[model samples]
Target chain A: MNVALRFDPVRLPDHCQDLRQEVRDFLREQVVQGVYDPTARSHGYEDICRFAKAVSERGWIGMAWPREYGGQERSFLERYVVSEEMLVARAPTRRYFVADRQSGPTLIRYASEPIKQRVLPQIIAGEAMFCIGMSEPNSGSDLFAAQAKATKVDGGWRLNGAKIWTTGAQHADYMIGLFRTSQPTRENRRHGLTSFLVDMHADGIKVSPIEMINGVMEFNEVLFDDVFLPDENVIGEIDGAWKQATSELAYERSGPERFLETFGAMRAFLTAVEGTDDTRLQEGLGRLIAQLHTMRRMSVSVAGMLEAGREPVTEASIVKDLGTVWDQALPKELRTLISLMDYDQYDVQAYRERMDFYTRMAPKLTIQGGTTEILRGIVARGLGLR
Target chain B: MALDSDDIHVATAERIFSDRADLQTVAHDRDGAYRASLWQAVEENGLTIAMVPEEAGGVGLTLEEAFSLLRAAGRHAVSVPLAETMLANWALAAAGLEIREGVLVPLVPAPRGHLAIDAEGRVTGVCPEVPFGREAGAFVALCDGPDGPVIALLDPAACRIEEGTALSYEPLDWVHVEGAPAMASAPAGTAAALPEMAATARANQIAGALERMLDATVQYAQDRRAFERPISKFQAVQHLLARLGEECAAAVAAAGSAADTLSRGETGDALLLEVAAAKVRCGEAAEAASGIAHQVHGAIGITREHALHRLTLNALAWREDYGTEAHWALKLGQLVSAGGADALWPLLASR
Candidate 1:
């Protein structure tokens, strides 16, 4: 069997250069105004909301969507440039990044017309926030094993289970959640799940904060205690959410955010090594930069494939697999290189502090989204090994 | 410049390779006689001079097309100097020299023997590890001259050839030219940037070879059985193959981007950055992927009887050609360092 994986070289278009420049200018202004700190691990909710509003006003949020829902009808590549710039700048994108990246697109594709009319506009206006509720206490990587049940009621469904590791759920206005609706068949273990759009403000829903190892409450355990959802809130096919779930993996996996999450550490490392004539340090830095460049190229090529209306599931999984592994290892590698340097020679205190935080954040890089093990399994199947 | 999956040139080259240069057949040919016919087939297809202009008495294919063809040549691990010939012809054409009919190899004067040019344009140097230097009829080299760099086409017969072989058993000979007369010489012109060009060529070759390696390893994993099932069913073996896939993807992306950059006629810092990154990244991929491929195939991978050795050994050998990971990494590091810390993101994002 042919196991060749294609990552076609795709250069950003000329227009993307202009868009990138505009993003840089806007980010620079934000930095000067002290709207958010690029070096910080997290931004305040107000800062995130303000920055999201500013970015939405520029027609960047929901950029790749149709213009009917406040989108600009821009290309995925253009949206790619915006997302990468925001990530590199470490902008306060926490409020709307999930909605812009996946939730809005998911709703556009599967939501009812009324839901789209109500939610897409709010998402595009930066007034709405979304959190993904896929992982539960027992179904982190094996998502098909999700036990969050949704039973049919008079006019809607009643959800009565807890979803763990629900990022941004406490602050989100809505959540795109998966609920088990029926039993799985012997042939297809992935059968019987359904997707629902949950209103966070709905009664019987409680979000309990879960503090991470990094001393951040960035995720939560969302408990749905007999929460009633209108029948119209169901997304796509009932007992067939598996189909919709797999289709979005390509878009969600192959993105700039997968690799650029710890790019701030790289920037800080560069600052510490500035003016050093050491060849060893330079070589290490060069290797890191080269790896980053290759990852970016692969990611961009996947974006181009997405633009061509092709679903490159395996290719996108390969990107995430490689990107997450590299990013997870980047902080430790940088730490090793910095450990060899003379401490008094350079002002590396700030960089060291950032490295400490990044080291803590690095473990979650591969664990979040699709774990490395699961991604590798997807890649293996793509290689026809399954 | 997205990779052209349906390029005619690549398809043609693939056809030639699949027909004439099957790895198993070539591996069994201990006498190495299959190389002549394979080289003749490739040369007759006008692939060697594909990068040269038609007006210059060459095939005149675009750089992208030529690199695609080279990538195909690499996938089969054809034991000849196809990439060398292409680079040589490109250098000769850039210097406005006549294209030679037989095998041509381009020599980059660094990390090996040195070459000096006198006022009369006679070349003197001993360049080592020139790929296929012993078999090549002529050599195209960019020599350091009294004025500047000079591009010269020299007869290989005039030089002393100390025959050598790389890990892949390809001809890698050292040539000592004691005041050998130049067949044709001119200002280096575009040929002066031979290091980056060579790196780009080797990067493409490494990418192609890595792809084939991945294919072979995956096939082996599926066919090989353990515990009454295919080893591929094992999660460990599957993950290993997946990592191999990642390395192959990285190599392809780096090399493809560099090829795209070169095809656009980028030079200097832009060219240096891309080519260096490609070489460094692809070289790293080669190192990591080869080990994993060997591990997946077990004992069969290391033996000469199996065809896996052909691709894996060549992948390792190609890492040292043009420039090693360390070599290019140093150059790239210095470049990045010179640009300072604030410029790093913009420089990377500019691509």
Candidate 2:
């Protein structure tokens, strides 16, 4: 199989410039209002919710979905511009990012009309938040090995297993949970798994915080003790979620968030060495900037492909793989360059603090959405090596 | 590799390269006998003057079409100076000078080697490591004249050509000149941005070479076997090829973005940023991809008999051609720093 990977050079449309200015103005207003610090590692939940609602009021959230679903019916490139602007600004988008990026799009495709009508409007209004329930104690990268059983009941299915590393589960309003409905067939081990839209406030569901090394409680272990999910909550075909799961990943993995996570620290680093005449630091900064620019171009190209109604799975994987690795290494490289400067020369203390946080956060960049190894395996499959 | 059949110019270039400049045939022709026929085929098809305007006695392809042709030349690892001739003709056309036929090379003076034009319009300076300088019939030199930058077309016989070879075995000679009369000259104007131009061209070539390297490495993995199975079955080899694919993708994206920027008739800082970034990124990708391709192919890749080194070595050499990674990286860093911290995102997102 001759799989010549193509990344057609896609320029942002003329309308996107206006959209970008709008986003920048909105973000600048938020910064001026003290909504959140763009350089901070995390934002308060109140500010996050406020920012999400503000973005939704502007019709930025769910802008790419249909108008019937409370969306603005804009192009995916418009959504891309807004998403990247928010990420680069380090805006508090944690509240509605998952729903807008992956869950909303998944519901638009797989969720029933009733469910879409019920939950999508709230998500589009930025009143709803979502956390994925794919990884468990044993199924980190091997998503099909999930043991979260959803036993059949009279009017619904009962979920009885736990999911680990569920980001934002403590405050999430909903979850698109994956559960094992039956045993895998010999022909396809990815069989028998199903997806359900579960209310996070439901009874018998417990969320325990998993504190990261950076002393952040962003991850959680969610336990469900026979929680009932109605039949109407089922998304797409039962026992065929494996097919649905892969498509959503293309959306999740190729966004600007994958690389812009450490951009705050990069900004801080530039500020720290603002006036230095060191050629080594200059060269390092240049290399980092170039890599970042290339990754952005690749990500934008993938978004363009999606806007053109094409599924660029391998291309998205390539972006995520390269983007994650670059971002994961960015903080360390910045630290080395920053270390070369005099400690008291500039505002090195704040820069060091930010770098410390980003360095701690870097380990999860490659592991969060999908591990680097899994991405490479996907690319290898695209190369027909499998 | 899947050719973009929709692009007729790219299709035509690919057809010619596959017919005349196949890697296997070019690799075995050690004495450079095929260079003449290959260049002849390119010139006869008007590929060298593809960038020159139609009003100026040349076949005028759009910037995008011309870049696509360069990519095809790189994919075939053609030893001829197709890209140089195209660039030289482009500079000549921009200056309203007569576009010459047959193997015209462009020479942009490096940081230390500054070629200067005297009051009499006599060009005097040594241009070190000029690609295809030994083989070209004429030199299109963007020199620093007394008044301003001047574009001078010089005869190869007027300069002393000390022949050298790049890592890919392409002739990259050092040309020494003392008061050589300019055959033709014009103000540089917008064409003074030859360094960025050359960087963009080299970036395109590197991207093309990386694509071919990926194709060749993947093919080899599926054919070469070990332990009763193809080595492609091994996870280690698969990962290596995956890394190669990533490098190739990065180079393509960066180079493609640069080409799009140039196509829009953008110059100054925007063009500088895109071209610098492309050169730096594609140069780094060349290093990574060449290393990975060689590793995957083992020792057989380094031998002269194998076709892998032709592309790999050329990619390696292309990294240093139009501003090495370090050179462009420093320039890019200065640009970014000068833009200040807050302007970084806006600048990147502008494109």
Candidate 3:
């Protein structure tokens, strides 16, 4: 008889609301300081570096990480709460993400004590950037076929290969590289790979920007030629790389960032249209709003698991899949919506650049960390679908 | 960010119901006492009085609270007059009866006849299928006037509960009255309150079943091991459960939104759409929840001994209680059709 109703969402803990306000205040201060413009930060990524530094100063970065490594060590739900606050503020937030969402945990799981101590402090401080190196030319859909190779040398490894789509490579000081280590006998190619942490400054390591369909050089083609990594740089055990890579990928795959890409625009749309009693707008808005709300809850739930010390890979996969569809749906849905009204058609132009920007950037949404097809296969295989 | 009493209320409701309404045990009541007790508990908890103003001697929680609470009730799979009670309360309130002090209300969604209570308080009605008519105090309906349906309060003493092996074991009956005194409607927009009024308890039932279904499926996934691992680890089960979880989450959010909308006195086709969607989804969700749960539970789930049948049966019963999928679907279909061919464009343009 314990299932009696005594709770609801409107009744969130008082502390959560307070935290939300605190984040709002910080965001307001940043806006007052003109650290980020409304247009630039509406999508939440303008002063990405400065934003990370400021957030770290407040101990907001790595809020859920253990305090020993410069994290505030808050509950996952509380972290989720902060994410919501940041979203509501529409602040630029790309920089602190790795430290907050992934790197903190990745180091805990896969890094050596030295690496955790050396890299985590800077990461926590947002002094270092990491452009995740996962995808290659033919390896977009099948990530394990990464042709990137790291040859064993005396007391070190000389990594030699190419990573075609590395996000933030221009600024990143280091890269988490998946490479072929053990020789594959054709049949067991996937299991033969190992992961490495390569210094971008190493000899012959080249980072060339790849202009995307969005016309932004946010992605890079990284080539490693005789780039030697000291034995000390080996992040995880040899041949046991996929486990580490997967744990890192799980962290990469989940969170509110998936659906929150266009949340600000949606809110702006809501605020701007208050004067009208348009029936068509309400119906269209209702369906999409409902979907966005659904995606957030699922994403939040997965974050809850991450906070609870559980690896919710399958859960994360579901969120990523659904979130991508909804995110991409923004443009398609708006296009359909725009064709209806003359007013919306003009307003659509006003928001067209950003929408187009988001649309092009969205293909990377699924393809960067893991392609949708690949993730689906993983999910299906995980679910015994195959 | 603070969770209101609504969430706590649902948690408390589901906890109590989940414990008692397990499938193997509910058969003993055979009659409706179990459901009656459950319904009274709901009333005592102030769920029944949710819409009444605080001065009216009720808990005065919003409709959202009622929606979530009833959903929890649905999850417990307890069959009763609970949702029907709200329909009746709405009629009484519409008929100008003090919900706390007057006779129990008649809850049938479409009232074919009327109950009339005059200033002298003489009551009369023929409200067939009025819930708990044999064991209630007041009943409210609308008698026909020169202008249409007029609100009427009726004496519970005048009505009767003629239960004849009802479907799904939740008690059902009719209230019959002749020459009942009739009162006017409550206020403006009261005529349009049917969708909101009917949706309150029904939405709750859906939320409850959704919660129960999710819990049962999760529990089964945990309990049932196959191929050397718990079946939950099976990616296919994970995907199915994930989709079920998505449906439940969406329903909970929508039902909550609809309840909040109703509380604001906003009644329109859109509001109807929200509630109707929740109803339809909840019905489907409950069945899916139960089916996925039973699937995970496997053979023992099909047996009478397993507690899942309580959840499944309630899901089955609630589907038909107020309206089935077909009923709500047709309602939604009509609403969607209102947009004409291009109706979907306006609805979709909400950006």
Please, what is the TM-score per model? Answer: 0.97, 0.98, 0.66
Task: For candidate 1, please provide the TM-score of chain A on its own.
Answer: 0.98
Per-residue lDDT over A1-386 for candidate 1, one digit per residue giving the tens place of the 0 to 100 score: 27668888888999998999999999999889988888677888899999989888888899989988889889999999999999988899989999998999999999888899889999999999999999999989998999999999999999999999999998999999999999999999999999999999999999999998888999899999999999999999999999998779999999998899888888888888887899999999888888888899899999999999999999999999889989999989998898878878977787889889988878888988899999999998888887
Q: Model 3 - which docking category?
A: incorrect
Model 2 scores what on Cα lDDT?
0.88
The numbered model that scores best in DockQ is: 1
If ranked by lDDT, best first, what sequence of candidates would result? Answer: 1, 2, 3
Off by over 4 Å in 2: B1-6
lDDT per residue for candidate 3 within A130-211, as digits (tens), equals: 7667788778667677788888899989888899777778767777777888766666656767777777877898889987
As for candidate 2, its interface RMSD to one decimal place is 2.6
Which of 1 and 2 is the better model by DockQ? 1
lDDT (10s digit) by residue, model 2, range B100-204: 888898988865477888878899998888898988889999899988999999999999999998988788888898999999999988678777878888898
Point out where model 3 deviates above 4 Å.
Answer: A1-13, A41-47, A87-90, A183-190, A245-251, A344-348, A352-354, A366-386, B1-80, B86-201, B207-242, B252-351
